[model samples]
Target: MTLSQPTDAMHRKGTIISVCRIGLHDIPEVLSCGLQDFLEKPSHYFFALLIYPVIGLALFLWASQGNAWHLIYPLLAGFALLGPVAALGLYEISRRRELGLEIEWQHWFSALRSPAFPTIGMLALWLLVLFFAWLLTAEWLYLSLFGSSSAPSGPLALLADVIGTGRGWRLLILGHLIGFCFALTALGTTVVAFPLLLDQHVSLRTAVAVSLLATLKNPLPVLGWGVCVALILILGSLPALAGLIVALPVLGHTTWHLYRRLVRIDGSVAIDPKG
Candidate 1:
């Protein structure tokens, strides 16, 4: 929250962030458009998304080396909490393509030069904090169920403890329930805020407020989108996190088009930058 008090006056500049209600059908349409965007520039998009697999492998190695095998699932599932931040560059790529600009790999970093970078940084920090909070909550939940001293020897041992006994089922049910709450918070807050800030001159508060309104207005479609994302990330994490090379870009590019459908900017003309 590095935003100063006077920054609130930016809202008085008369920018109107409006939310639109959309049906479930719009989900596939946006995904299709996002696929088209990625296909048009697959090499550039894939190169830009290499960070996801790299991070996944790093996390896997860290968990393995530390014998924190119990954390492997939580750490991987927690990725959804940070997905919006990871996809910032992809949003910029989709934005450039929308404007019919000739794009290069370097353009993925365009979000860094945005007028709203400070605000975007603040939002990204919030997501990071949320991610760590989830990890801690997950650890606490495991400790309460199995005691702090009971560390499993490996992934197999961990799986046996989690799936073989009654407490294991309890952990599974309760863990997923709690994880759902964290995921919902991330979705409701930033599902559209990041892209809106990048695409418009609106204040952070206005952008987040509009994002929440969009979620509330279109709960069914938004929820479906979240479910789809969770499933994709789960599948992508299968091959040593290699699947994200495709999952990340498609989800990232689609998110921009999704934001376009969810929120409409008014009162200020959105400028298309020229090279």
Candidate 2:
């Protein structure tokens, strides 16, 4: 598809990214819309196909180490932080479907060819850095709390330590609070930026500015959206991450619809496209 067709003079000057007001009610609505999109285009094979490499990489990194169980919770929780990057292809699917274009697995590569690809890469890099930072922080916290002791032997032993000890309880409370801060940062930075970059020809600054503004305008709903995503991801992770084969695509599609609801691009302002 022609992702970079030249726009009118107003659009060339840059379109205004308008943030719309929404409510807690919009969260469920967008989720319902996302599920409908998933049902309409059940791309189970598509996501299942893509996830294998990630699983392989994770297995290579942690599977051989018996003591890696301490970081398992952190790794699972950090999935939300990098979700925007993972959902890029799914966004393209939703975008094409929304525009009544024919869908194909080939079209999943559309993000790679977008005019905003470099900027998209930059935003994705930011998320990657955030993900690594989270993992480091989690490791440090674990060391600070229980490093003096030997690492737990397996998932059950680790679970017992966490649920059976005072320091473990402290880790639980602090880890979640710290994790929430990271999640909020990610939500504000990318809640609109990634989809906007995919849907429009805009600079990184403009897309990010609009995303932050949209989150500010609808703080409660956006927060609710983050919470809902975390809950779903947690539940999806329960079945050895097999559930994500469905959960990730559905969430990805829902995010596109949520972005449509949260922002309205208008020909009112001039933004520098190069930024």
Candidate 3:
């Protein structure tokens, strides 16, 4: 009877494994279904794009009260706050696809239902990292400009000192170098890491590791994508941030595509043997 009990347990385990296998194989089809859902739902896309401008306008109004330089902090803070808002839109796209429903603005609240808190948390973390990166680059720029010393009291004098030194040229180079290094380090992981975190209940460490591996495995493609991202950022800054209306959404959708390409959805290998 004891031997038969062991055999029965093994049989039950095999059945569970088979069920999991079937679910894993279904992932590709699920992904396709999701894409189709998004394509069919143009209203949702429109609403997502609209939100950015509304938020931007509000920031502009708030910052109009302060000196021009004071506005930078609020601008950065606004963008950080909006990261989750953007992710919520992406989540709507993914969730509607899962339900085989057409995308619409109405789907926004629905998308916020699942993985909402986790998505917000991850976005907040990423934005904090981005803010620090900006600060580091800003400090580098300031030092490059002022030569690491106390500045003159008068605005005119400060301007004169800056103009007298050939530091502007060097600042440009140093800023670009720092930005490039930061991009490369974060290239692979950022593309898919957040979406994966939202989609799966897995720990952040696993998702980040998987993302890094994906980047290392396809360095050329990831680097190319990074260059494209940099170009878009530069271009978007040219027309008083008007370019962001189009640039941000395009990059966001493209990132979704990149993530789809990189992550292995098939749970063919046992993630946890004990399970």
- Estimate the Cα RMSD of every predicted model relative to the unseen true structure: 5.6, 6.0, 10.6
| lDDT score for residue 65 of model 2 | 80
Backbone clash count, each prediction separately: 0, 0, 0
lDDT of 1 by residue, 1-113 (tens): 11111111123367755677777888888899888988987887676678778988899889989988888899999988999988888888898888888889888888888
Candidate of highest lDDT: 1
After superposing candidate 3, which stretches have Cα over 4 Å from the reference?
A: 1-42, 45-47, 51-85, 94-100, 109-111, 147-165, 268-275
Kindly provide the TM-score of model 2 when superposed on the true structure, using C-alpha atoms: 0.88
For residues 21-109, write the lDDT of model 3, one tens digit per residue.
11222333434444454466545566557666576666666545442332343354335323434655665465445445565566555
Count: clashes, candidate 2? 0
Best by TM-score: 1
Ranking by lDDT, best first? 1, 2, 3
Model 3, position 22, has a per-residue lDDT of 16
User: TM-score of the candidate numbered 3?
Assistant: 0.64
Q: How far is candidate 2 from the true structure (C-alpha RMSD, Å)?
A: 6.0
Local lDDT at 234 for model 2: 78
Q: Give the higher-lDDT candidate: 1 or 3.
A: 1
